[model samples]
Target: MARIKNGILGGVQGCIGDVEGFIRNGEAFIRKRKKKSTVPRSVKQLANMQKMSVIGEMIHSMTSFVALGFELISKNQSFSANNAAKSYQLKHSLQGQYPNLNIDYAQVRLSEGQLPVAVNPIVNLMDNGVQFSWEIDADQSYDRATPRVMLLVYAPALKKSYYTLSGARKNAGTDFMELPDSFKGHELHAYISFITDDKNEISNSAYVGSIGPAFIEGRNEAEDSFKAQNDDHKDVLTTKSIEHKDLLIPAIITIDDIKPEKVVHTKPNDRFDKRAKAVMKRIKK
Candidate 1:
């Protein structure tokens, strides 16, 4: 493929007899038109196509969450964020065989990184919304406490998701995502991950538990992590509840817009809270 230059022809997006011009991710390009293949697809080839179709369909709806999860890996590697996400799902999340293929939600990972993941992660449904919590270590010698949480909840029946990109600090141990009215009486699968306060890194997500009416499945005894902490610790943690009610939004991507678009933050320091900045400063000391 060749890029359309800034000239008389400028850019094109259609076939002009012998040449085919197109725009991908807003970049214009041209290539020679080729005749359609006349050969039949082999069994193996057809199976691969089916796999890509199913996986691509699932990835199409959650590009926003995928962008945050795969941002670091995508930037460091050759693949784009959406492509990197699809590649991982294709290799790991699909279940059954070709004709009977499906996505195993339990195995689905929204984000991947070298950062340490949440220990003993859990999720609970409350009157306000679904709250996600994780065990916080007291050790503060490392760069572990300040990364914000990424709460992801998928409703299998709805084929859509509700999530937040930047949430409470890991040390805060908990965050809430307000659900839409449509989520009433529906089951949801929850996953939690972490992204650096600077947005430079992320952590692999953990499937906390599956939610149902008054019950949780897949978790040994999934309850709000808040219930297990010391009463004194609760006092400190409760004070750290940072409201991101606005960021708790749903995602639905169009089929044509297949590429993952990067979400650019205005300025890192502007988003950092005073408390987190103080904690980081003290930890670095």
Candidate 2:
């Protein structure tokens, strides 16, 4: 009887401990739920989260190798660090002459607190080519002193791409590019980017949607032949051949003399005379 009473006490103690633990966890959860955020997370803030951290880590790792190379080159007799610095400046100077914007993120900032202006391109389909136009007034985010446009056109079916550069001022209204006949019936996609003259900063690419020639049904040679031969008959028709060789075109036959299916032995003088008399009456009238 004493052992049974001890067992009951042990069960009661275990239930009390579990109840206390549950109460503490519930209170902590309630406290967390009561905490309020000052501002809701914005799209840009969410996107920028960990962006700088990853970029800084990548730059740090790359700079270590680049710095070591530069130090070793500084000690070398053939190429010094001063020479490398001058070479780098010269290379960028040459690049400045051209609208050289390969990667979109590589674009440098123009001024303090300035970012690339988003551009909306108007893609037009022409009879023989395609045209691109954008409203310069819409780009009010950054100051564009001298603007350069990069147009990229791609044909997925043809697996071909064409890109060109145009000055925003020169092509004020619209810019046209002639497409090849092979681009017919294939979908073409276009993207446009702008570069600033002072900073050579490239803007984010704006997808202009699919722009290309209209879909045209090309003539199928095999279908054409089959349709022509089987138009009015159910029998499978074969191309005419002289012997066993297939001919592109059948030979034409011309006969000078005509033969009737059944020749009548009756005299033709009576009919000829009646036709002559009728002709004379009409002429006299």
Candidate 3:
């Protein structure tokens, strides 16, 4: 094949008109002609070619593989770039080539790092339930990609956790979650993770730490009542009381009727007074 540069044919074949095809720049002038080679390449040559192939794969997998002359600012940035590069390659590989590639959460988190930032989540005590808000590192003016916020709320007392996701079209930037009455009183711990619009990227997660009901003691009468009840009964009914009708019934009794002189009161007695009173009342009747 001869390359036609400036109307001049270059590269040599075997004969004159035997130049069966010609190529100009990248465009082929004619159909491709196959040439047969009888001599086999040396083992060293084949090994070198295989090594170079892997090198190319590594380069393609590196997110920070600048052409040749450019420099990057930080090593951490370079490392993250490399991860991004590897992720993109994996994504491409799985699209049509390899459909069975295992792209799980760990891989996605390592590669894309696409999650948004959750900053200064405020857990406010409210009257009816719990109100929460967080500063999302998101903007309404840009990006067609919607924001998704996920929360994992746990109550140590309940030994259970609740998982939730933001609604469709909700911007996480100024988003908030209003927990139902089930979250009231008992201390709760929470953490948040974010997803951008494409669902292909995610950000690192942030722990909101442990937060009690928005209605803390002295904050409101309801909270004060909750604390008073919790104090009087060490294993007081938690917010889960909503699930059990019997638990929802507030304790109703009067220790004021007990003649103070008739009973010997101690620290333990003070602590178990309610229980003892209930037991004694049951026994008396």
lDDT leader: 1
Lowest summed lDDT across 10 adjacent residues in model 3 is found at: 65-74
TM-score of each: 0.64, 0.34, 0.33
Going through the candidates in the order shown, the clash numbers are 0, 0, 5
Which lDDT tens digits does candidate 1 get at residues 161-262? 788988998899998889876666677888899888788878998889888652233333333443344333334432122222112111212223222242
Give me the overall lDDT of model 2.
0.44
Question: What's the candidate order when arranged by decreasing lDDT?
Answer: 1, 3, 2
Please state every model's RMSD to the true fold in angstroms: 23.1, 23.9, 18.0
**Candidate 1 — worst ten consecutive residues by lDDT sum?**
244-253
Task: Pull out the clashing pairs in model 3.
Answer: 63-82, 114-202, 115-202, 115-203, 125-214
What lDDT score belongs to each candidate, Candidate 1 first? 0.73, 0.44, 0.45
Residue 205 lDDT, candidate 2, scale 0-100 = 48
| Candidate that beats the other on lDDT, 1 or 2, i.e. the better one | 1
Off by over 4 Å in 1: 1-42, 213-285
Q: In terms of TM-score, which candidate is stronger, 1 or 3?
A: 1
